[model samples]
Target: MKKYRIGIVGATGAVGQEIISLLEKREFPVAEARLLASANSAGRQMQACGNLETIQETTADSFKDLDIAIFSAGSKQSLEFAEASRQHGCVVIDNSSAFRMDPLVPLVVPEINPDDLEKHQGIIANPNCSTAVALMGLYPLHKRFGLKRFIASTYQAVSGAGAAGFDALENELKAQFVPEENSSTATKDSPFPHPIAHNLLPHIDDFREDGYTKEELKMKNESRKILGNPSLKVSCTCVRVPVYRAHSISLSAEFSQPVNVPDAKAAIEGFNGAELWDLPNANRYPTPLQYAEKEDCGVGRIRIDQAFDNGLSLWVVGDQLWKGAALNAIQIAETLVEKKCLKWM
Candidate 1:
């Protein structure tokens, strides 16, 4: 077993911090871990594997001598730094929309398309959170039954918007409970356009002229690429919920062949990286609160959808920061090593 010198861009952000925690928990053979953030966050210290590591400013030269760099920064940073990291001979796993639509770059989900890792040109793009969470349960079923169409409604958490979104939800909740000089003052500069404490916003990302949001379109396009089915039909309505972490999806999928409840449950249960919790008798089902802070996505509420003959309705919950972003990137990095695409540092 060999170790790799790893660097995490945007180390001070929420996803970046989760990457550090996951790398430690999974024992991913990291020889050295460098935390890099914006200039203001330089010299700030963060804990990784129980040792304090100082955050460095992200510059082109920062990637020198690094073997693997996991980037959770926004598109602006990824677009600016990804090529620089690759130019320094480092394998970059980017968790942003910057390169996902690139025909050359592989938009990957390890369990579904591990082979895509071999085609990477120094950078691999992690799928969006809503897309990732939906596919965690839907992909396995697609394998069992030929998937033709998919309609999903996402119950996304505030944390998906990063730290600012989380703070806004907290402040709103606190304002609702605590007395304030004026309620408006508490949520004057909320991260979201409206309150998220006791409300559900129908929009996730900016809406397009066609009525679908950017987040919703990511699900449609990314799913087709990952599934290798360009003709696949997918419609999604991504919503922002008040929860702190994790994301849930109500999926109704129609397959080429008829799928029964028992078969669907079996398909999900037998799949890797997914678990079935469809025990209606016990009133147990997947939820954001239950799957928060966990690795595996939970699938439950399995039943035949009444709308379509070959359709099944299922609910899935997964940690958006983990499987949706950090863990997925780490898994891709692991796949790169396992496939000999990247050498140990």
Candidate 2:
């Protein structure tokens, strides 16, 4: 196997940091590893592979010699630099919404559609964390029953918003100790509209004309792309929970044929990136707290849905920072290499 030269944009941010750790943890063949950040954050040293390397300022020249560039920067940054990175002959796996909807770029979930990697024009888009987690359960069932529609309610962790969201939750919870900051206005500048400590925010992103938040729409749009189901209807409600890591989604998916609980469990058990953990009698189900930092997305609370004739209800959870973002991007890069779509260094 030929080692590839890799670069990471947004190396200091939440998802970016996870990509760094995953690349090391997965033992990705690395001819060289380069870290890049904005000018303000450049010059900092990150310890990796038994050595400390200085983070370079991102420039047009940053991707000059790299084989793959993993981007976790915001959409605007991705919009501006992804093409530049690709122009420099680097394959960009972007963890931003900038290119997911683009006809030329592939929106991929390796377990669901690794074949999408073949259509990439040097850029591959990662699905939203909530969308990614929910489909882990939904896709397997779809394979058996043929998916037609889905309804989902997501319990997303604070970390999904990045470091600011996590910091806001941590600080607000800390403010409770001061005895004078218990009021709602104490965390007014927080990422959420209300204090997210011990509270749930129904809104996850900016409200669209239809009243669905951007995060909610992401679930609808992204799932359709990943599953190659353009007619797949998704109704989603994304809620921000006080949890700090994994994201959980409660969903009811209707299929083309009648669904069975035993068959659903078997399908999930056999799925590549999913697990069946439903045991109501034992009161055991997949929970965000339980699946934190884990690789496989967990599915539980499996049952036949009463609302639809051929539907199943289930709960799914996975660490968004991993299976949803970092690990997925790494897997796509690996798939490209394995298929020889991306050249070996």
Candidate 3:
């Protein structure tokens, strides 16, 4: 096996750290690992793939020696440097929304559209975390029953907002235990509009003019792109939950073909990236805590929907960090390798 040189563009953050760990955990044949961050994080030392390396400030030349670069930096950074990395002969698997809808860049979920990778001119874009989780369950059913449209409600975790979001929740939880006099210690700079502890926020990304948040719209757009169903109507309500990790989605889908509980169970179980967890009698269903680190998204609560002639309701959960961000990017990288798309100079 060829060990390719790898770079993590935002190595100090949560998703970047997860990407590094997954590269090691999956034994992705990494010949070298480079950690790139902003100037502030430069000179910081971390160990990955059995070696300690200092994080380097990203420059135009950062991808010079890398065969592949997994980017978890925000959209602005990706937009600035993704093409630079590609020009340097590195394949970029970007985890931001910067180029997802670009006709040139492949918006990919390997389990659903690995073949789209071959068309990548330079970069491949990972879908929004919630969209990725929702599709893991929805795609299997879409395959078995021709999907027409879906309505989804997502219960997302704080970690999706990065370290600050996690810290805010921890601070809020700790404040409850402290005496009233110690209230000054509580901080409220959380990216969330209100406290995320014991409360739900009905927003994820910024709202579009149409009243849907960017997160909600991404599910609709990205699903259509991945499913090759531009006509696939998706109505989603994205909510941020108090969970520390993972994301859960409740989906009601209307398929062109009729759907049944038993057949839906078979479709979910038999699918590649999703597992059937519908044993409600055993209290067995996918939840944030249980599916927090698992690679396979779990689906359960499959039942015929009463609203439409061919509608079905289902519940799904998956680790946002795994299947959503890092794991999906790595899977795209793996697909590149398997397809022999990585050519040597």
Candidate 4:
């Protein structure tokens, strides 16, 4: 077996930490692991592959000895360091929105487009968290029944906003029991414009003039690219829920061919990275609590949509930090390995 040196940017953050754990958990033939983060988090220590690795500041020099680099930092970090890593003869699989829509970079979901790795110009882009979860259900159906369009409403977790968002939700939940005098200390600084303890925020990212947010737009555009459906009509409403992890999406899709409940359930069950959990009569369906931290996305509530002639309605849930971000990025690398797409190797 061949082992490759790997580097994880933003090693101190939530998604970055998951990347570290997953690399070891899934055993991706890592010979060496380098943890890189901002200067402030440089000296931090993290456990990986049963050893404590020291975090280093991310710079151009970070990738010289690495075979693969996974970027879990924000777009700014990816934009600044991704090309530099690629220039160092390293393949970059990015978790940010940096190069997803770039014609040159391959926007991949390993289950949907693993073969696309062959054309990567040293960088691969992971889909949006919500888009990734939605596709786990939609893509399989698209294969069985040609998909026409989809409308989705996502109940995203606070973890999607990162650790700070998690803290905000935690603090607010604690503040509920605190007296008014000390409540300010708990619910003071929040990443969301509104409270997320028990309430919901329909907005996820910056709003556009068309009344859609950037996060909403990501689901539309990214889905089309991954599915190879440029004209695919997608409308999504993104919401932030108080959950600590995982994301749930309510999807209604129109397909070219007629869709029935049994065939739809069969498609989901047979798909890789997706499990059919529909048993509403038994009071079972995919939920954020059920799918959190699990690798497979769960799809349930399959039914024929009355709104469209050949349409279906379903619910999908997945761990955003895993299938949505870290797991997906790692899968890209695994696909590259399996397909022998790593040019540097």
Candidate 5:
């Protein structure tokens, strides 16, 4: 067994913390784990692989000695340090939008596209939280029935926005004294334009000229790329809800072949990293709270779509910090190891 020296950029963030915890939980052959963050976050102590480690300020030289680097930092850090990490002979698995659409970088979900790891040019991109969770339901179906298009409505958690978003929701929930007539009475300081404690915000990310938000478009664009189906159409509406950990998506998809509920359920059941939780009699379906902190995304409410011929409607839920970010990034590293794509190989 070979253990590799690893570096985790943005080690102080919500996703970054999850990455560190997952690395220890999964026991991926790690010889050393260096936690890196901003200068302000430097010197902060955190636990990783059973030892309390000091967080360091990330710089160009951060990856000089690491064999693999999993970046949970946002796009700015990824764009600035990813190439530098790669140059240092470290395989960079980036969990940001920085290089996902880049023709050169492989956008991967290990269960769906592990072979794509072989095509990496030092850096690999993880898909959006909603995209990754939704795909856990859609990919198996796509294999059973050729996928053509989908319409998705995502109920995203506040944690998806990171710690600040979580705090904003938490503060508002605690500050509520009276029932305000309007939901807009929410704190103006919230990261979201509206209060997420009780009301829903139909917007996620910046809105585009085409009326779809950047987050919604990410589902469409990233899905197409990962599925290798350029013609696949995705119409998505992303909403921010009060939940604090996982994300849930409602999907109505039309496929080329005729689909049935039983087979659809079976497809999801047989898929890796996905669980079939449909039990209508028991009133069971995938929910964010239930799936929070769980590695496997849950798919339920499987049925034939009423709107489209040869279509199916399903619900999917996954932990935003886990499969959506940290777990997926670590899974990519595991895939790299399994595929022998590391430097030693």
Candidate 6:
């Protein structure tokens, strides 16, 4: 029942702010919480536990006396500060792509691979937002019927790109919709390469030689790690939508054994952390607005995919900032403390 001292890196960013809010909402037993950001945001103030706290510049000394550190900064910042935090006896839960592919680092999804947390050498990597949300519905079904292959197309939000990404989408929409007198000039300062409003960009990250974006590759790679099946085949297409928050995915999964529509619906209904919203009669199913600011991912539109012999088609929606990033990190920290995986000072 002891309280632990915690620090949040990138405290001013979108995902970092969500971490602060979630920690307070969940009533985590935190003795003290430190907010750390870059020099540009060093003097900014944020609320935590009903008190105002100032953000300090993150450095090697930032982890002093902290028991657990949650990192949501970019991969570069995590790569630079993760070891320093660990050296200070702090367990780090990183929400970036920095350590996901590292052989020594464990890519974790609490429901799928909670046991991997025990083998951590002070650092746990949260999977990509698209991967996390997609797996929330798929993992449970995979347990019932062995998974043979996965194919997904993601509709990602602007917030996933950080605050600037949101700003860009706002500015683009204003310019495209508002009257000429009220509209401001749309510039290149926005996150995406082109306007995101009224447009669906088929790219999420850098393009590979094969034309798949980096975000798409993450879904393929991270899924294999979290599912504990290195041989699991996966293909994905990641797209950037104009939404402010939450992400949705259209998935088609092939199983090793034959899976019928009724059984798939039953499996989704009984799964933990997932809910089935299928009602073709009412024309209702999961959507980004339905899952935004919520913890559980909503899944629906279950049916047999005609593309593969044993394939099932489904859609999933989840708050990228919550289940995809902050909540997942907090859950990992909670699991560690609850299981006595780490000692509080």
Q: Provide TM-scores for the models.
A: 0.96, 0.96, 0.96, 0.96, 0.97, 0.95
Please state the error at residue 305 of candidate 2 in Å: 0.6
lDDT of model 3 at position 74 = 92
Worst 10-residue lDDT window for candidate 2 reads 177-186
Question: Tens digits of per-residue lDDT for model 2 on 100-128?
Answer: 99988899988889988887789889999
- Candidate 1 positional error at 269, Å: 0.7
Error in Å for residue 12 of model 2: 0.7
Residue-wise C-alpha lDDT for candidate 1, range 1-345, written one tens digit per residue: 898999999888989989998998999998889999999999888788667899999999999999999998899999999989999999889998999989989999999999988888888899999889889899889988889998999999999999898898987777674434434332666667767777778988799999999999999999999999988999999999989999999999999997898888999989888889889899899888999989899999999999977999999999999999999999998889889987422
Tens digits of per-residue lDDT for model 5 on 310-335? Answer: 99999999998999999999999998
- The global C-alpha lDDT for each of the candidates, from Candidate 1 onward, is 0.89, 0.89, 0.89, 0.91, 0.91, 0.89
Each model's RMSD to truth, in Å?
2.4, 2.0, 2.6, 2.3, 1.6, 2.8
Give lDDT: candidate 3, residue 171: 86
Where is model 5 more than 4 Å wrong at Cα?
Answer: 177-189
* Model 4 Cα lDDT, one tens digit per residue, 1-345: 999999999888889989989998999899989999999998878788777889999999999979999998899999999989999989999999999999989899999988778999898999999999999999999999999999999999999999889899888777673335423232566788877776778989899999999999999999989988899999999999989999999999999997888888889889999999989999899989999999999999999998977999999999999999999999989888888879843
Runs of candidate 6 exceeding 4 Å displacement: 177-186, 343-345
**Model 6 per-residue lDDT tens digits across residues 1-345:** 799889999889999899999999999998888999999998888788677898999999999999999999899999999999999999889999999989778898887898988888888899999999999989877977788998999999999999888888888777674334534344578777766777678988799998888899999899999988888999998999989999999999999989898888888888777888899789889888889999889999998999988889999999999999999999998889877887433
- Which TM-score value belongs to model 3? 0.96
List candidate 4 segments past 4 Å from native: 177-186
Provide the lowest-lDDT 10-residue window in model 1.
Answer: 177-186
Q: Measured by TM-score, how close is model 5 to the native structure?
A: 0.97
